[model samples]
Target: MGIKSFQGARKHQQAGEEIPLKVSDYMTTKLITFKPDQSVEEVIDSLINNKISGGPVVNDKNELVGIISEGDCIKHISDSRYYNMPMDDDRIENRMVKNVETIDGNMNIFDAANKFLNEKRRRFPIVEAGKLVGQISQKDILKATMKLKSQNWKK
Candidate 1:
């Protein structure tokens, strides 16, 4: 059992000679985006219906504007009796959130990990040249972690 050869660790080859693993590979491509004018209730329902915890928020031009989380809805729930109450037609423009954290699809997993682990972000909205594309989450990062470890084990 000299140095316990890594022969068996080749099973988790997430990347190979012909294919390279990327954030986009693991990210949720079919993103469920939100409009700033979208009601908090609507976002909450979307999160539940899609079985996702968060997503990117985009404007009418499909530009990334903000990122909304399930926790945001939970906090907003304390603001009113009916959490689903639609936004006031007149206030719709002002109701949509704008501050959101985003990342590029080509960013390495290590950088993504550092951003999420060292920063205050619960998730990252995947963006491309100012356009909302998809989203990467803590769950997605965890998956990358396992995959990276498995691949390195064979080195």
Candidate 2:
């Protein structure tokens, strides 16, 4: 789904009391991704350039291998400084979360929101057929919930 779909969903939801919203309706389809073999410096640059906290680590085939976040990157800074090595020496594969928790695009938004609350994660990679497709973030959930609340108020 795209931005238009999200708007449609929002409008439809506003017109009714209950309209089921799925992750696909709110998840971001455009993504900035990383590769496992990529240098930490490059990853950091990409993340910063994209104005994102992190991104999914995908293989050449676009398969989800891991996830990298600011938290993971922060944990390596001291070590790199102590070792007197460039951040480029660190590979994202070594720093990324290998056992990443992923969500399906068709998943219920409420379910995804619960996962965000319980896991305390900022974002989740949307996996379909073992490939990274999109992402959903805590901010996205917050926006969606706020929209829902506003729609409720219109009734």
Candidate 3:
């Protein structure tokens, strides 16, 4: 006199390998870069045309040397008027931030997001062997999050 089982047999779920999300996978490979000798006016034009806040400055070897932003361009314009110097005379080398911070391409997306939050930076350049490879922005992190919305977040 055993009780009858009404429910069907439970299906066994297979454990699948989870892939680690890396910054390089979500970073932008093609970038709008600037040269040290380029004029601030030209940088400003590129920034406006591209609708970007800033860009990286590289050397002849494509090595990251600095970063130039809208703030720098504005400062150059202000300084030009104050010093009575022509805006055309200003160079990216003088206006760009020389001591630039970069991030690794293999870093986890969560770690990269944390870095962006801690550093208060909109984007971080990815470098390998002293050469600029790509860049990851906050928007890219957001896109990654959206893409992984169904997956569990792991460290």
**Which predicted model would earn the best TM-score?**
3
Where does candidate 2 have its weakest 10-residue lDDT segment?
7-16
Predicted structure 3, TM vs. truth? 0.87
* Candidate 3 per-residue lDDT over residues 29-138, each given as its tens digit: 99999999999999999999999999899999999999999999999999999999999987899999999999899999999999999999988999999999999999
After superposition, the stretches of candidate 2 with alpha carbons farther than 4 Å from their true spots are 1-20, 152-155
Q: What lDDT tens digits, residue by residue, belong to model 1 across residues 59-133? A: 788888766777767656654546555333222124334666577788877778789888867678777877776
Give Cα distance to truth, residue 123, candidate 1, Å: 1.3
Candidate 1 residue 104 Cα shift, in angstroms, is 2.3
* Model 1 lDDT, full chain set: 0.69
List, in order, the clash count of every candidate structure.
1, 0, 0
Residue 74's C-alpha lDDT in candidate 3?
A: 97
Would you list the clashing residue pairs of candidate 1? 36-96
Off by over 4 Å in 3: 1-17
Which pairs of residues collide in model 2?
none
Candidate 2, residues 1-155: lDDT per residue as tens digits?
A: 65554443334353435654788888988888899999888887887888999999999999999999887887788788888878778899999999988888888788898998899999998988888889999988877777666353332
- Alpha carbon lDDT of each predicted model: 0.69, 0.84, 0.91
